[model samples]
Target: MKAVLGPFVPSYTGPWLAGVDEVGRGPLAGDVVAAAVILAPDRPIEGLNDSKQLTEKRRELLFEEIQGSAAAWCIARASVAEIDRLNILQASLLAMTRAVQGLARAPEHVLVDGNRLPQWEYSAEAVVKGDSRHPAISAASILAKVARDREMVAFDEQYPGYGFAGHKGYPTKTHLAALEKLGVTPIHRTSYAPVRERIEQIELF
Candidate 1:
């Protein structure tokens, strides 16, 4: 791993550097949500780590704190229709791009949490597992995860029996069984293999 200057490190780059991350790539339903966060020099948030590594309660706490502390932050998403039209990977990237663009102020540079940088105009760098390595990216990851999870929970209410609240729209056994029983919903990503197969099966029968 290469060293970088971030708030987590002593050689802090100014808050102009925004960190970007996205969630919901593997979900069979809902949108791919992304977030960009710029942590100010004055606010140094602790417990900044990968969202996946934290408990749901911890992530929820961090999500709110990050919003309150960050100099600027934005959350954006590519809708289910957009996910079907554009591939998931592309849609995820597009969500991240939109997040950065939607920030309160444009960043001088961006540190993306994945290995692949989005098709973006701003100066950017991709850090593998950056959510764990960079505080700002971790903040973005927490925000994105919390936001998407809330959406899935809400979708569970709207589209009952799919267990969106529990599985968060992942291709879990419960979700697959629900799809088999309840059929696909409007939020389901028809482009995904599992969802597509179910759709094909439904069409045949």
Candidate 2:
């Protein structure tokens, strides 16, 4: 689909606007991932949208198409340790900054898919729900979400029973139950209230 470009989204001939988005901030385990996508002026991928709005199959399809068509794309992450050390918002912004820095080419402007912009040198704007308003931001959201979901699947293999693959470490009923039964894993964010409560419960008992 043609991008839902708006006031915040640039329609310039130059494909120099990099869109950034992050995923996994709410997860009690694993890292926060972010992606920056600079879409090509000549190449337009139909059905580009917010990753959360797309089905898994559609996201995977667009993920591949985005890889082949985008002018530049990069994925980066702040680990669980960083999440605990820096708070989720700061950690998410850090991941976004890294994603932008890791891009193959520098962007003239950055559009992030949220209300707050990271502290970065680049000219940037924070758009509320930019993922649905801008194609590049949508692409970035897909990449970050898909990449982090895949990481959670891998984490499931290493740390079974937490249902990382299913819930992706979110504070689901199953995940909280597992945390109570199994105690906190090293990947779990101890700074989180639920995880901390579980840890305290274990220590108390």
- Among all candidates shown, the one with the greatest TM-score: 2
TM-score of candidate 2 versus the correct structure, residues matched by position: 0.94
Task: Give me candidate 1's TM-score against the actual structure.
Answer: 0.93
Which ten-residue region of model 1 has the weakest summed lDDT?
3-12
**lDDT tens readout by residue for model 1, 68-182:** 9999999999999999999998899999999999999999889998779887688888887788888889999999999999999999899999999999999999999999999
* Candidate 2 colliding pairs: 1-46, 1-47
lDDT per residue as tens, model 2, 1-205: 8655464536443669999999988889999999999999899889988899999999999999999999999999998899999999999999999999999999999998889999889988888889988888999999999999998999899998889999999999999988888888889998999998888887886
The root-mean-square deviation over C-alpha atoms between each candidate and the true structure, in angstroms, is 3.0, 3.3
Candidate 1 deviation (Cα RMSD): 3.0
Q: How many residue pairs clash (N, CA or C atoms closer than 3 angstroms) in each of the candidate models, in the order given?
A: 0, 2
Q: What is the alpha-carbon lDDT of model 1 when measured against the actual structure?
A: 0.91
- Where is model 2 more than 4 Å wrong at Cα? 1-8, 11-13
Stretches of candidate 1 above 4 Å error?
A: 1-12
